[model samples]
Target: MSAETASTRLAEIHSRIARAAQIADRRPDDVTLIAVSKTHDAESIQPLIDAGQRVFGENRVQEAAAKWPALKAATPDIRLHLVGQLQSNKAADAVALFDAIHSVDRLSLVAALAKAMAESGKRPDCFIQVNIGDEPQKGGVAVRELPALLAEARAAGLPIVGLMAVPPVGVDPAPYFALLAKLGREVGLTELSIGMSDDFEVAVTIGATHVRVGTALFGARA
Candidate 1:
């Protein structure tokens, strides 16, 4: 897309966010929209960066490793967020590539990340992922287990910055987002990464510090 087209679309997305914030009696600046660039090429993201989007999210570590190098070569200061499940083996690569990881869900992953951080000499900011829906198959820690998880990550000198969650597929997400915000406060955290393409407005209204939006920004992923 042309820079003009990208700028127009981004403006529209910002307008929607502004409107939603207004409806919730919020300042638009209170919410940071993280354009999810998981399946998108670096070509697709340049225009977005030119249009003044400074933050972007990626789902898979390897794809990010491939894309981010080129993207960063062009836009050196762009902030990269990892919003996907990360495996132990991939921890070093992820620590090297991402500025933040919003999917720290298990004790083992935490230990692996600590070891990787030591090896890489890079400490990526992290969020504790909460399985709020309590689905047996999901990839987050049980909500009740978060404090212990945060404690362990902190002891490793990781910047445990916030909490993240993916609400169950067809349900209302507001309550869950609110729960995260509450948990963040209880834990003295400053970030809450929640919501996505579908319910980001609700998240902003309920005090989400970051919202990961993909399809709404880039069209549906293949």
Candidate 2:
């Protein structure tokens, strides 16, 4: 998309977010819009950057490492967030590249992240991913295991910021969002990283602090 198109899209999404926040009695600034740039390359992402979008989310640490360094060098204010399942083996790279990790679901990953943070001296903000739908195929920690995981993360010195979840598809998401918000509060976490392209507005209404918007911001990926 052209720079103008990107800027227009961003403005539109921001307007929607602002309206949603207003309706929810929350400041628009309280909810961050992370343009998920996973499959998109740096060339395609630059227009969004030019449009003043500084926070982007990526799925893979390797892809982010390959794409962000030069983009970040040119635009020093950009923040990269890892919004996909994280492998224990990639912890070091993820720590070095991402400003926040939203898929910390297992104890092994937490331990790896802790060690990586210690070795690299870079502590990325963490979000405990809960498999809210209890989907066997997903990567988030089960609700039953959240307390222990939260304690483990804190004890390991990871900066546990909040919770993240992807509700089941083709269903009303308000309840899931509400559940995440409730879980976040119960765990003493304020940042609820719940929401995506389709449900982000609902997420904001239900108290999402971060929304990972992709297709809406950057048209359907090829």
RMSD to true structure for each model, in Å: 1.4, 0.6
Clashing pairs in 1: none
lDDT of 1 at 23: 88
Write model 2 residue lDDT over 11-110, tens digit each, in one string: 9999999999999999999999999999899999999999999999999988889989999999999999999999999999999888999999999999
How does each model score on TM-score?
A: 0.94, 0.99
* Predicted candidate 1 versus true structure: per-residue lDDT over 1-222, tens digit per residue: 679877887888788888888988988898888999988998888888999888999999999988888788788888899999999888888999999999999988998899989988888889999998899988999988888888988997787988998998988998888888888899999788988889988888888888898887787777
Cα lDDT of candidate 2 equals: 0.95
Report the error of model 2 at residue 75, Å: 0.5
**Looking at candidate 1, what is the lDDT of residue 219?**
78
Off by over 4 Å in 1: none
Model 2 TM-score relative to the real fold: 0.99
Q: What does the lDDT read for residue 196 in candidate 1?
A: 88
